[model samples]
Target: MRSSSRLKRAALPRSAPATSAGGSKTDGNHGLIAGTAAKRRTKKEADDAQGPSKPAPKKRRKVIPVKEPEPAASGSEASTQTSHADTKQPEQHLPSLPLDVLYEIFSVLDPHGLIQLTHTCKYLCTVLASRKLDWAWKVARKNSPGLETWDPPKDMSEMRWASLVADTSCSNCGAGGVTSVDFRLRMHLCEQCSKDGLIHSSRLAKAYPDLLPIVRELVPYTNKKLHSNKKSDKYFWIDDLQSMDKKIRKLQAEDPSAVDDFCKERRDLVKSILGRASYLRQWHARYMESRVDFRMDQIAGRFQAIGYQFEDLDNPKFYLHPLVRLDTPLTDAEFAEMREVLQPVLAQIKQQRTKAERSSKVLELYDQYKKTLLPIQRIYVPDDGNFLWKYPKFSALLTRDTSLEITDAEWAEATDALPTYLSRFIEAKRDKHIALMHDRYPAPDAMEFITLAASPQALQHAREETMPHFAGPLELAIATFTHREDTVVRYNRLFTGRELCNSWFEKVKFQFADRESGLVAQMVRMAGLNPRSTTATEMDDLGAQFFCRTCHNTDHERAKAAQEPHTLWACSWRGLLDHFRGSHPTAIKIGLVNHEFYTLERTHNVIDIFENWCCNHCSEEAVAFLPRQAADDHLQAAHGVLTPSVGRDVFFRPPALNVMAPHGIQSYYQFKDSIPPQASLSTKEPSPTS
Candidate 1:
């Protein structure tokens, strides 16, 4: 009997996808024994062990294709009914199936196969559409690779709900949801059906040897090529090595290079088919990103949830992994050692930082700080970049009661003096640093741009993520106060803020012009702070975004306070990116080449090119950026000379949208597992492997 027909007989309702009881498709007897003819079982006899008897014929339409009322029975209706009731019985006993085994059997079928079997017959459909089955379907769908893409038939939703009411409760869970039984059953159906049922067939073990029947059926095609006058079956895998050797000899005689290229092409085709492995692995990646987006998205709704907006979420990697609770308490001895050995050194370093004259001097102080801060009790790391000497609460710390704190005249003079001093510093080291041109660099007031970029949501949901909103005060304040072109440019250009609006058509640029360095120095002075004294906190969001009263609108404190949320938006160090992109379409597409390179860098090819270029520089500072292994290999292979960028086609592009360690699969897992056990770790290892 045909497989579909056998399945239909086993299931009466024409819904169950596969096998059934005695008369049901699931019946082991439905198929012929190894070498014997299969026999049909009556529905009644199948339902109950009894003598063979045909099932009653279902009523047919009248000759006119219309239904006609049946005439009344001639005999005593009550007595005849009693006799008929006595003749009938429940269904035949079938093999027992435990729930776990059944669920396992159902899990392997892909969604497409499951749908085909569902239309076979009624009795089978009832079991397939049961509530227990629905729950299993849900679990399988959640875990399956491609089944997540399946969508169920619309009518099944209502039927599943109705089925739930008919059943006492689901056999699997003895529970129900808001929906009815049939609806739930249909909703929870498994995606994999054909393979699952085939496995359960009694003959499956014997059929295993002939498992690839589909392939065997194509033997005619295989033999044709093998026997062809000019062609040979060189690419096909043959079990007999002798036969394969013979085929290879024939191919070499026919045309060796043609065979070679054909084999190569076949290998390439195999890899292309395996590409789905690449796609499926990244399936949950976007899901994880969405979770982060959602968390950050809540900032406006509940600001307090943020640990402290001292920075934009800097530890994005750690956040996505499982959260770890550090419950271990420090012992008395540990605490004492920490305080005695570390606290005093930290204090000394802080004092030296206050006295430092330049960044190099501060770098020296940092060395001491790191040494003294061992068994580190408290250390602040900035978000969105840089560090400050103190934690930021800038407006509160710098504000005075009087209106005459720092004069406007003094502010202008300080700003004017900055350009020349910075210019001299840049010229002295012109060859060492990449020149920042006025056309490419950001203007002094670019902090305003950053303030506008900060936004609240995905900026995309599937394809659309909304820009975050931040108010105007924060933008004006940061733009008016910040002096560094790089920081201002980074803040203003890269992000999108929901609040601040700016004209993308107008572009302002700051030129290095041999002046950026001294201007950097004067910038610190004019702000009444020393960069050398700045801690991680000061250089980050707290200092850059909150410190400058002008950025915070402190001069008109009441007016700034009234702006509240908008004020927060204005001073945001990164939000302006969103504003520009939303308000100025031209701004985002303007740097076309940069965007294209970024696409490649994301896949890690860019790093290969970067190491090649930087290897030529040879200077200690120049080589510091390469990954440890790459740099070590370069020194050994390139004779200690830094690789010159002169003839190289590669350039240092910006880092990936989300940067992580660029180690391959096995190394990433090892590195992750090596982290302190108490620290939270992701179940998935970062895979940079192609």
Candidate 2:
């Protein structure tokens, strides 16, 4: 049967290929081929009856003739035209989108984004301003974060409402930084604009006396309160008042009877405005607050992205910066611009905080060391008190790359090294003192100077010469041991080492006493008394007075000019030594003044001697003069010093001496008992004298 079908298909004279229901060729179906062949024959007969077929003609399309662009008269015009063409081409495509598609795109944006879109081109502004797009604005407002709860006022358009709330600019001047809105006036005003455009209620009467009462009643007002407790002044929009006034005047001119009706309508309008403004005001406040919060979050994210910790965001230095506190969102480009300035400031703040934390930790460790380790360490080495940390090596050991904790092993290491550090510190201090002394008093040979310093007499002489002029070992030790690198060191507290400083002080006092003894002996010998046996008290009782030959001769003119006792400069035993050591560093020749002459000079020149005394401890310039009792009281109260010494702590001022008459030589014992001695006058007047 297959062979018969194939022969039949071949005999069909290659009929048109028959297709299956699915439109595939069916070579094996003989019935389909027969049907296809019969239909082709019928189509050929129909074509022959209808004759030749022809193609239908195409419909003509209307051609739009475009004018060729004119050649520019200038390069600027050509460039302007080119730019306009470029911008116009892109702008044309955007508006070519379907109205529904544009609405859908705008509806997804917030009011701020929608407002920004309007600023891009005039086409967008016109389309967005159309009443047809009003639904799109409403959708945007509804989708916005903080504006969802509030609707535009009845009299306000959605665009105007969005601008009033979202635009950060003064409506009148168009200046930026106006984050707040005045809903009552339907505008945003900067601080300066608010001051200039809003009329205070008190000022309204002066500015427009005739319209004040009606304007105050009809126009919605804002309370201008500068302070919390102050009484707020009612501020009306100047533009509102002018417009209301013109309307009222026009109604009176056109229809006098309707004037009242117009006022009543305005009153109702104002009521509505005020009611709507209240809700809008609350909405604006929430909006601004949310914007500020969003901006702050953006700032924190930017900082965190740059490797700052979450806790670092809470630092006032970061949060209070003007950039972080802005009510506008931070953009990546803005962060890039501000990073140069902000990164350094943030780094400085972080460094300061780290230093403070490290200092606090070191202080805590020091406190523990002082209470526990110090007492045990003091048994081996002299106590440095609070000055132990002043040593650079010791401080480095305590603070060198240490963590917050001080382990027992670390403490043990420090304890073991304390004696060596203390020894080094002492050696350095001794070397410093010697170097300073050698620098201050340069010698021809350094070895010879050291050899001389070791001798008792040479050392005493050196001390007498240099101690009054230069800082001694004790002063140098205090300065070096208590010095701080960060701040000026206050020498309010005394620094004393129990074994070390006390022994040095004792040596200083002994050396000073030995120098004073030599001077006292010279004075006793000048009084013609035995230098070995004559006590200081007996010499004072004798009223032994001495005069400097050099001062008597050289200072005669100065004494005369000062109106001082120019007959001869008389001095007591202590005054003689002070004058010789201070004024006459070279060998000074002195002779004892006759007792009668000395008494007479004292009687004439010692005017208010007790009143001219000064406290050496308080007065560095020796200009603070006080009476005997007042000086004693001041010493006790101010310095906690009792029984101040005469020549050492309190001295007679030189200007207190008056010119005296000359005297003849007489026996020293004759007038010794003539002057009844007082303890304060025991040190004779060193005034302009030797």
Candidate 3:
């Protein structure tokens, strides 16, 4: 059975797809186990007992054919009615499977396995294909348990809802590994089915005006596009298509006078549950992200206990393990058991890795003979390339291999070739990484691009992500993570990191350059602030799209009240960047980058950058703007040096307006209550600007 199961899994991806319980083919969707989508389930999760790691189907371009009416030859109405009665059953085999017993057995089977069972014969297929049999799958889903939450649409039938949990295939088409379910549409389909089968409710309404009233009464306008300028999309709920069709048909049976009342009641019910499913879906998504973050921190702590130090806890290695992602959270004893299971595999990998390193070094010397000495010295050997490591003439450097021992004459020749190889190898490697251009250096703004690039989420970035909507710090984290460029020089200093990729090397070249259009667009559309302070160009020239928009009109601000906040956006990315640098001070630092790297709020001339500068010795702005030497002297004389600064410009922009911290820099979680209280430092002394 174990071998059979292995064969089934191995053959699943390449072979013809298995059919669904309703006798539909689920194909072209079987590949790649769910990675992050796998979560820490508990022991109670029966659906995950066999550990399929139930992957979402691989996205591809298979078409979704329109569903046709049920065939008369598919099943007999007489058998369906009389099978539940005392005389006879519709099933030819499995005579003892009372409906309840059948459900009990099927409850343990996932959708994929249950579908396969139904395909055994036409009798088994007909027996399982009726509406009454839907309860069996429903019971199966309810009995199943896991970290994943499946909330079916309000109008969907029980069997359809159960299919999402019991099987990993499309009921309509038999697409395998179909984890991406849409409750609003009432189906778990592969990507193409989603695009092809489901039409927007608005589009449907326009096409069929006669049925428009019924569709509008049941469906709602929702799921806004990520773009702020686009209209809200409409969707018709079709999870329980039979039930929806039944309801629509019942109106035809009603008295003409009573039909209006029935329609009104239906509309009211839909409105009551209108966004309920959407709300739950959104909540689940947010919960999953936070849970992944929490689990990663726990893993980092566990590694720290075993002697690994991780300065950046958010690093991908901590959170992305295959077993960690797929398995349920184990109790202490279970974790110990799992650890024992993995120890041998880990040891073998480590041993092979060590030998491979030694083997590579040995091969490098032979490679150098071909690359360097062969052209000049005409070095020759009897064996083929890679002979040195494959058929060693001397003992393996890292292992005991008696056969590798050679004669004294061979040793002498080997020694002659090795001396010059080391220097040349080191030089070659250094040359690859050291040479960098001016455009390759990174500045602060590149963090967002870096984070998205480094993350697993980067795979869908172009299709799904909209960078203009991200907050400053989140964007910076992404950029810092993914960008890898070798930068030799910057404004005045130099960039040391070779983290930014080459493609971005070109983009960052003109990123903060004077009056770049891309930067202007980001400032106006993304950061929600104007760059008027830095750029001389107006919003119109950069294209009015580079400003805050309401209904696609970026011509001017949407009219409101004077007391209300501004809706208009600015045109200069650098202008807003400079404005943040000047007015908000540590906002971009606290918001975009960590505070450990920032020294102080850079002053313009001889003035306090932000108004909140308070001193331990003097509770005024006078000490805040003074040169470092003067601040130390005031603290030493007035405050008795009890509170001393290194005279290394570490002063902060203390909060005003009876606040906890500065407004934009509120994310500085490390510094709460650490700021000094207001006091007098110097007696209004004069100081020179540095």
Which candidate has the top score in TM-score?
2
Model 2 C-alpha RMSD vs. true structure (Å) is 25.0
**Alpha-carbon lDDT of model 1:** 0.29
Tell me the deviation in Å of residue 202 in model 1: 30
Top candidate, metric lDDT = 2
Global lDDT scores for all candidate models: 0.29, 0.53, 0.37
**Considering only N, C-alpha and C atoms within 3 Å, which residue pairs clash in candidate 2?**
none
The residue-by-residue lDDT of candidate 3 on 237-282, one tens digit each, is 3333224445666766765577677778767756655546566556
lDDT of 1 by residue, 425-518 (tens): 2223221122232222222221111111224231122111111111212122122211233444434223111111221111233223222223
Clashes of 3: 35
Listed per candidate, the RMSD to the true structure in angstroms reads: 32.8, 25.0, 28.3
The better candidate by lDDT, 2 or 3, is: 2
Go through the candidates in order and give the clash count of each.
100, 0, 35
Model 3 alpha-carbon drift over 4 Å, by segment: 1-91, 95-104, 110-112, 115-139, 147-158, 201-206, 220-231, 235-253, 257-261, 272-274, 279-352, 355-690
Candidate 3 has its poorest 10 consecutive residues by lDDT at 679-688
Candidate 3 local Cα displacement, residue 482, angstroms: 33
